[model samples]
Target: MWTVAGEIMGLWSRDIPEPNEVTFTTMIGALAQTDQFKEALELFRLMLRKRVPVDSVSLSSILGVCAKGERDIGLCHGLSCNAQGKQIHTMSIKLGFDRDLHLSNSLLDMYAKIGDMDSAEMVFVNLNQHSNVSWNIMIAGYGNRCNSEKAAEYLHRMQCDGYEPDDVTYINMLTACVKSGDVRIGRLIFDCMPSPNLASWNAILSVYNQIADHREAIELFRKMQFQCQHPDRTTLAIILSSCAELRLLEVGKEVHAAAQKFGFYDDVYVASSLINMYSKCGKMELCEHVFSKLPELDIVCWNSMLTGFSINALEQDALSLFKQMRSLGFFPSEFSFATIVSSCAKISSLFQGQLFHAQIIKDGFLDDIFVGSSLIEMYCKCGHVHGARCFFDLMPGKNTVTWNEMIHGYAQNGDGRSALCLYSDMISYGEKPDDITFVAVLTACSHSSLVDEGLEIFNAMLPKFGVVPKLDHYTSIIDCLSRAGRFHEVEVFLDTMPCKDDAVVWEVVLSSCRIHANVTLAKRAAEELYRLDPQNSASYVLLANTYSSLGRWDDARVVRDMMSDKKVLKYPGYSRSVCKNDTQMILENKQ
Candidate 1:
């Protein structure tokens, strides 16, 4: 097809009769559709060279190709200027073609698409009569680039002047609302819809979904259906997202069935969402079935399947699928690498994690914050805390999550001093710590027995930074005091806990009491622990040990007898067998 188009050009220049504007317009349209925009531009240049009079018909055709913004609009603008610069307004000087509205609209659209609003306004203001098509393009230009305030102003003014908005204008406004997160303003626009079409319904639905109001999203879908407006691909996609968030497997299944009902299962977008929904809800078998039915795959489809496998803890499968993507000639995107790095974290295989890390560097995505964060987490979880630190330092930019990862990595590796040092550095550099940062910092203080430091940091959190303490912060404080053997202090603090005691909090106090051999406090902590974790045998066993260590033999025997009656078997202890130089096998008692 390309060769024939090339041959047509060869004949046109040699001996063919002068081609009319329609011929040039038709050929350019075909070339643009075939993605040969450069060749089409060359043909337009040839016409200009031969002194063939160019009309708005030919000008608009070339402008249409620029509308995609794939071509250099600057060069297009230059050509438009050369053809009609200051001397001839092609839209006004049309001779053979009856005032070409389509071409004139395309010219206005090209200027807007390139963000050359000065030229666009010039064209717009010069229009002999305005049409909804041209007006819609200008409104969309503002919205497409996230100029919401300007879009709203222009849209409102356009409406006040008696120009009724079409479906395109409403979609633009709805998109603006979704991004701006003005749900109230979005609702106002929704009510103002003269006649809401399927696209408008889907737009409103997307706004609700983005803000995470799943119930509202679904309710809108139900309303749309009850109004007899059939759901399209976009509607099904939105419904699938709502189902994923709610984890309502039944609703997800219903949506999948609806997709098949409307032959939308073949849509790569909707099908991908279905796979994601099933996988997120923990139905791997159903996810696999949906994934296998997809006829073709884009990056989105591949990412969905890869993420599904990752979420299901199928590490080997996820890696294999990623390799398959490359072997099938699909370029792995940043999301693909991030997903594989996460899988490596779960499997705790440093070799695989490094392999993916090297691939990320090769792809130039190693600097991407998402990929960098994943690499740091993978290295930390795999016992390569130093390697994780190295990557964190090498990252070009760091978000709050990146800083939190480093802090948590230090705490998990028992480098409490280093964690505290990093926290100080983070503050010195003016990076405000979030709640997760406080958790890591407090944990570090707890591990290092720095009670005074922990208290200082905790107190400063609410007053100095306005970050109120969460359950994690409270737990960290309790754990720090207990690890320091301040059992009485822990008990006093527990009495003042604003939130009810959870298993972890009670476990903290109980563990400290057992360490200090405080019989009365141990008994109380045990009761609280048992209330939180009813089936916990360790709580009962620890309480009995507390009694035995205190020389209360009768009370200890009674606790043991109760355990026997309840079939709460105590864990047996065994010593390890080791060779002189190398390791040896030993059969330890099974708890």
Candidate 2:
């Protein structure tokens, strides 16, 4: 029928036969499949003019067109509210399709796609009997809006209402749990499944993987295979993530073998995850092998390979691959930029980072907070904090991440005073500072030896900003006091901290004592640091150096003898400088 209609339309040329409602609807469906929505809309209008019967399928086809083609979220919402979906909705009601489960479900899904959750709920609430699919749609909609608790609530409510969820529904629920990182609830949901499929197993495994429960993820995967449910692409993705975090080379090989056995090695998502896993585990050769075997690549594939190279400090290779991706017309997402720019920062490739920054501006993503923050980080790391500041100031809107980046930039550049000032500015602008922001501000004071200022900011955070100091924040304050030669104050502060004395806090004071050549405090710090990081030879070496710097020759000799007795040799110091376009190792000391 479609072929005959197409032939007729082709033969008529400019004066094509006026298509009837059924013919127009079928043609619209075809156009929608090809994503030629504008022509479909015109055909629908002609059908209305000719008074042809507009059925539910025809109405839903137009709504699908609006949902797919509309880019503006607000405009899509307005369309769902007014003209776009209005006529079709009224037609559905008049034709009794509103009472039809399939038509109503499609309308709910369409509104959800357009971010018209209110309309979707209205449609959902009016349903005489809600299917598990409808319940899942509502849950997924809430998840899309970052309302994970509401999503979980809906899932619970669905169960309470006696709608047994299918695999799709469980996937949505598990996804919400993953997003919320509510492992306890996720486990409960997992336990309640009548007969869990491989996908559900994968979701459970993923929840564990996300929360750094690698041992649990591995155990779950073993249990999954024992149950004779073969791992699919999703299963492999989660398994590889666990291996990546744990760097369990031996177990990762087993997962790799499983991938080959299942023949999911060619799957792009699985392959990408595998590449990331191998790269993070420091198996670059295997990462390359996996990359070479994949016949087709997506943006994620490219990103994974680039990220792998960057993680291994293979900056040049990463850049070359990035260029290859661009030549293939694969536009880099913000994540790609973030990775490449961070690699640029690591290698001090300011020129390349700047070039990427220019490209970001040309692509009109300069205002995007993620991209802007990446640029800021790269600039600060390359000793161009002023450039970073300029970019940050020009950002149209500042998110918490962006603000954190700017504050960190100030801290890294030794402008801790400026960082503290920016913190004040951030609060004045009504933007609440997160824990990361407080860390940056406090670290700035520590670096610049602003003990009093650091104390004030640390105290103000709990009351004024309502940001309770974390371990890192407390450590930074202790370091600030130590840097100013206020060792007793640091010791007193440590005694009063709510959290346990982290090795990092002890290390901070120890290093500060070494810098100031405070022998008495250095001994106290050394004792505490050694108790915390017993295997760290740096602590021993640093304490010995403090004694040497203070001309306490006997004490330094005794410290060195103790190190020798323990078979803990000091790591040789080395320095580097870029001279005439060449990196030269200028110094080295051997035992």
Candidate 3:
């Protein structure tokens, strides 16, 4: 037959003179099979030129072309294939294949591949009859949009329509459940699989892994081992991730040995995970050993190294690694830029932040919300309120996080009025306030002695926004009242607060008592603080300070001697000053 012969001739090219429709269609299908999609599209074009009759088979082949084209064509190019696809659609209508179920399914898949769910859904609704493939494609479209409810509805409708769910159906269904965090449903599906493959097992474990059920996932891994199934890179990655979180050093070593035995250690993802595991375990030497033994470093490995340094408080090392990454011709991603900016923020290095900000603007990453948030926080940390506000205004997309950062920036700068104004503006802009928003505004009120405003916001929390006040909210209210010397009000408020075990609230009250020289209230607060956090040196230090403030030298000496006996240490605070001669001095003496 010409069909079987065309399959063989697919290996080589020859011009066939006066080929029939079957020969042309067979050749085109073979071209697509060999991944010569461009050639396939070209052949389709030639068929159109010769006015060859089109049918469901050729229409499906070209429709497959559109889907593959969207993927293979990067973001900037690939319009020509789409243009060709539009012409194909017109041809299909003329050829009476538009109503063909298989052809329509191909059209649906093509539209979904390119993120046009509207068009995909349109085709689905217009179908005269539904196949398992149709149901699966519809579910996949909703799953891609994270519409788990709609996906679930379709699964029910598919069963009602007497179409048995297949492997692809369950896989897409599980993906939807995973996105929705319906672990219960995920388990049910996994249990129903007649013969679950490795991918199925991995997907199930991934569900447990994402929700941070470390013990459950580890137990599942052990079960997999008992079944004598080999652990792939994903399995090892998941297990090592749990090992890092739980700090199971010995277990990590065993997993590392397993990875080595399976020869999966050389894979970049596994290696990056290994680096993260070792880094988080505080095994810097082991981490470096792993890095050094790597065949070569990739971008992910470099970012992991930088993240390791940043998390371990080695800001300088993180910055150094970032520079090295760039010098090695690795362009920084959003995560990389945010991490580096955080290092600058941690060190309060305005100069370095400005340097990176310049690069961000030049590279057009200034519009990146993550990087912009980091920049705003960094400017606030470095005492550049104007810079923080400028970035806040320039950010085109201002979410609740951006608003929170800007409000907190004002609060930290001691501009309570501006902070309140921002909060009002946030309300006007319809950005809902979260817990952090309340914390920032209340902190602003506390520092500025806006007791009335603080109390009003505190009262409005539950009624207006349905946000119940937490320990921070209560603590802020206490600070606000105590700072204004409303000692009686502080007592009533503390007694009425819903949360009683708040050591932080007591600590704030103790500090305020020290400021007002209220030895009685200070003693009560210190007692509660010591009871809550026995080892907190702040309680002892403030208690001793309270005694000294009352001119009770003997009592102060007694407190100091008690601290010495208990081995409590003071956490010193620092201040930096520049003298008249422009010489800088840093002091770390007392609070």
Name the best candidate (by lDDT): 3
Q: In model 2, what are the clashing residue pairs, if there are any? A: none
Report residue 8 deviation for candidate 1 (angstroms): 18
Q: For candidate 3, list the clashing residue pairs, or say none.
A: none
Global lDDT of each candidate: 0.79, 0.81, 0.82
Q: For candidate 1, lDDT tens digit of each residue in 1-591?
A: 465446776787686567766777788888878867666766666666666677776776776666653443334434543333212335335453324667657766776666666777787776777788877877777666667777788788788878988888888887777777767777788889877999889889988888899989988888887888889988998989999989989988988887898888778999889989998899988987887888887999899989999988787789889989999999989999889899988767677888888888888898788888889888988779999998888888998889998888888878888998999989998999999999999998898888989988998998998898988898999899988888777777788878655877777777777777878778887888767776778888888888887898899898788778877766676665432112223233445
The candidate that wins on TM-score is: 2
**Cand. 3 Cα-lDDT:** 0.82
Per-residue lDDT of model 2, residues 339-432, tens digit only: 8888887777678889899998887787777888888998998889999889889899888999999899899989988898888899899899
Off by over 4 Å in 2: 1-18, 31-46, 56-91, 95-98, 107-166, 172-195, 296-299, 316-338, 349-375, 386-403, 421-431, 514-520, 541-567, 576-591
Worst 10 residues of 1 by lDDT: 578-587
Question: Using Cα atoms with residue i matched to residue i, what is each candidate's TM-score against the true structure?
Answer: 0.69, 0.79, 0.76
What does candidate 3's lDDT look like per residue over 153-178, in tens digits? 99999999899998888888888778
